[model samples]
Target: MRASASWAIRAVIAVTTVSVVAACGSGNDDGTSASPADGQKLSVVATTPEVADFVRNVGGDGVQVTQLIKPNVDPHEYEPTPADIQAIGTASVVVKNGVGMEKWLDQTIDAAGFDGTVVDTSQGVTLRKGDPDDEEMAEGDPHIWHNPLNAKIMAENIEKAFVAADSGRADTYRKNYRDYAAKLDALDAENTKKFDALPADQRKLVTNHDAFGYYIDRYRLEFVGSVIPSMDTSAELSASQLTDLVAKIKATGTKAIFSESSLPPKSAEAIAQQAGVKVVGGEDALYGDSLGTEGTPQGTYIGAEEHNTDTIVKALGG
Candidate 1:
């Protein structure tokens, strides 16, 4: 929630600048036109702060980055405005989650005819389907960043895209990717140890929505069910659905009813209260579709995951 309001203000500034220079092509979203080899900071745009954080880690000081989605906003149902369109149009490189997650982005970018490098982080990673047979993740799940391994893959792709966009910084991008990938590997190992301590049954989670499929899949935990069945947080839970979810929680003896900060906790809390379960606190608000406040633990992808892992281990393992 920290970066969201500030980011919105910055977005307004960026969008205003885009409106003035949309037709001029002043070096995409970053405001730099020099080629990557010329050592000029590359202008880059990513759909989410997580992506932007990855870019910053890999791009380092050599790249200028802009993130479209702010912290604590549900990206599943986010709508782009005229200013957003301008920002997209003016971007030289666009990195998006790309698994039909941001439904509005493709249409918006295509409609604007924004001709720039587009990188889909979901590329190449095998997707886990929510419904298993749901046509949405037939190719691969777009939520690739959910797992650290998948995040490493995203880092590699970001490197490739940065190289393509700015050939001069190819070496810088490659080194950055390698360093960041190593950091992610360490994080993965650490989280693996944390999650490994839990009894298998205690790992079950019933949540506000289907946001943690990848996290559950990665740690070998059971995703008992969701307060809302769909991947979209904007969807409301029905009375029947709430009753059913509560029934499941009671049946499974679910230890925690989880909620993301971006989404309403009322429904999940209601379910928790009904189930007579203690509401688990301190789980870093899961960055399902966005990042967190800058400088906070959830501000970056690694930081967000670290927050999530600590919270999950405590909530479920305890």
Candidate 2:
């Protein structure tokens, strides 16, 4: 009778322990769940390298981020493969630049049955209206991170998502966010000073596309026109549109025609030639859609922003 009693007690204890263990590792209420490899840290997936970097800055050592898109691969035209879905299959959190940047994100995550919170960094950002010519951007611009002020806002949103998913380290996440935001604030101030030095009329920009609305608008520069009337590089340009752009460039007295690093510059260069303006591109090309390759100068968000400022200043007669 004593032996039987001891055996029964042990069985109940085992079952209780198993239940607690399963509950600890189970998914969260917000649809996030992950079997952590080392029984610690969240598996996070970011839709773009920019958002991936933001997650890194905010999550610090508490997360392992998987970037959905790579360098030079335009997210606007990206199509997720089976491997991409499988790579993010086990994520506890997924971050995205949600002003319609990653159109494939929701569908892919839903289809893959991703059980995680999709954090949209653009939640608090004041988005610019899409280029008048691009019907696809009826929702607004997705390049919120282009403006340094918006970058600060994105950091806060990302921090909130991190805390929600890993409340155990809420303090650490908040501290990290504060540190990252300080850097963004300093960058914004620096860019503000640089742009302030340029005369208002000289601040006008003629770029590869209409992607600089937030950026130029922030710095008080007039977005005189673009080589492509659309915010997206993939948009087709008619001869009449090109001619009108040339006319606008000449009328605005725009000194330089800026072509994006991620897009083909042949059209911009042709426009520059036609308008007799300098083409500021190549290494000096502004990182419009994607960041630079990892480890390169412009691979980082700050580096990319600084590059754009310096390149534009030099080209536009800073």
Best candidate according to lDDT: 2
- Lowest summed lDDT over 10 consecutive residues: which window, candidate 2? 17-26
lDDT of 1 by residue, 116-200 (tens): 7788877877777654444544444566688999898888888888887788777988998999999999999998898888888
TM-scores vs. true structure, each candidate: 0.86, 0.88
Instruction: Give, for candidate 1, the lowest lDDT window spanning 10 residues.
Output: 1-10
- Report the C-alpha displacement of residue 17, candidate 2, in angstroms: 34
Tens-place lDDT per residue, model 2, 152-219, is 88889989987877878889999999999999999999999988888777887888777778898789
Model 1: lDDT equals 0.74
Among these predictions, the greatest TM-score belongs to: 2
Output candidate 1 Cα RMSD: 5.4
Model 1, runs deviating above 4 Å: 1-39, 130-140, 281-284
| Per-residue lDDT value at 205 in model 2 | 87
